[model samples]
Target chain A: MSFLAAASTNINPGLKAMGYGLSAIGPGIGVGIVFGQGVNAIARQPELTSTIRTNMLLGFAFSEALALIGLVAPFIYTS
Target chain B: MSFLAAASTNINPGLKAMGYGLSAIGPGIGVGIVFGQGVNAIARQPELTSTIRTNMLLGFAFSEALALIGLVAPFIYTS
Candidate 1:
């Protein structure tokens, strides 16, 4: 009985950590895609460099925020 | 016994996902800085814009690939 209780306690944290990890996947891919597209756009049109860069930064910020949200989710749910 | 096992299995995926998510941070910041610097460089010297832009995109792609690797990490670890 004691062993089972100890095991459960250990497993709970592990599962929670896993959930947090999985949540980051979308943001990770999202940031990469956004940056890749941004780079390509700039490469194609040097004249609109400033405009493109502003938009790219904005997109990057949002995507990074997604990853941050994922990191926080486990604590939010578990607590 | 069965419940504990099931819980651990469930948690494993979430942790893997979190690991993937955390992995994106460096690349995200790196791409942002690269683009920002690229833009500034172009703004300062319009004539060198073409060269600067090309180098910027190359840097961006390399940073982006880091995130791509993060996305693929889980499958690599689990398998």
Candidate 2:
């Protein structure tokens, strides 16, 4: 029982990292989609490339923010 | 027996945060797809930009709802 108690504290040092990893999963795919589609959009309408690229970047920023937050959220919850 | 209970109490404080991380994943990708395809649609049919944007936003909201739900879900489970 004492050993169990000792082990409990040490059991999940990597848990925070794992949380960040899981959190990043969504954003990673999301960024890929935004850029992939953005490229396709540009190919379809080269004249609107500027507008399309701007929108794509905006979407990228929003999606990437989630991953960044995930990186920070662990510290927030732990503390 | 008391020590076992004590150990259990101290375990996995970060579990809730991990729950949130897992939950965010699907919505993240979903949102990306919605916006990406929306942008592509707009480029393909520039005249329909307004309609495309409206639909894109609706899709984004629905997908974002899932992640927001995930953020709140851990508390629901814990309490």
Candidate 3:
């Protein structure tokens, strides 16, 4: 039990950064999909390009904000 | 050996929450993109607006739920 405890006790400061890094993967894919699909839609219908573009930006903003919050969470909770 | 062991014992609970927070970032961005582009698609193809809108809502809800899951992970795991 002592051996197990000691093994588990080893701290890794990088673990937090690693977690944050892993979290970024999904958002990256999501953002890519949003824009990729939006562009395809716009290409097919140029008339509504502005509207599409506007909504795309808004979506990107909200999602991106969540990521930003995640980035800050460590610091926020620490305080 | 003792010095190394001594350095290893410190653990931060924040590390886990930081992990959960990190997990949220991707889904957040994902939901944003899904909805944003869906709106754009709807604006362009007004006829298919309902279909696109529904799908977007579904996607957003799913991704948002994932983010919520991440939000709760630390509480569940640490306990």
Which number leads on DockQ? Answer: 2
Between candidates 1 and 3, the one scoring higher on TM-score is 3
Candidate 3, DockQ to 2 decimals?
0.34
Candidates' C-alpha lDDT: 0.61, 0.77, 0.65
- Rank by lDDT, descending? 2, 3, 1
Clashing residue pairs in candidate 3 are A27-B26
Q: What are the per-residue Cα lDDT tens digits for candidate 1 across A19-61?
A: 5565456556655666676676677667776766775675577
TM-score for chain A, candidates 1 onward in order = 0.78, 0.86, 0.75
lDDT tens digits, residues B1-79, model 1?
3433323334555565555556666666666667656655655566786788689778877876776676666666644
* Candidate 2 lDDT: 0.77
lDDT of 1 at B2: 43
Worst 10 residues of 3 chain B by lDDT: B1-10
Model 3: CA > 4 A from native: A1-12, A76-79, B1-7, B10-18, B25-33, B36-44, B48-51
lDDT of 2 by residue, A1-79 (tens): 3534433445444777787789889989999999999999999999998878877886787777777877776665642
In model 2, where do residues sit more than 4 Å from their true spots?
A: A1-7, B1-9
Residues B34-73 of candidate 2 have per-residue lDDT tens digits of 8898889989998888888888878887887887777666
Q: How many residue-pair clashes does candidate 3 contain?
A: 1
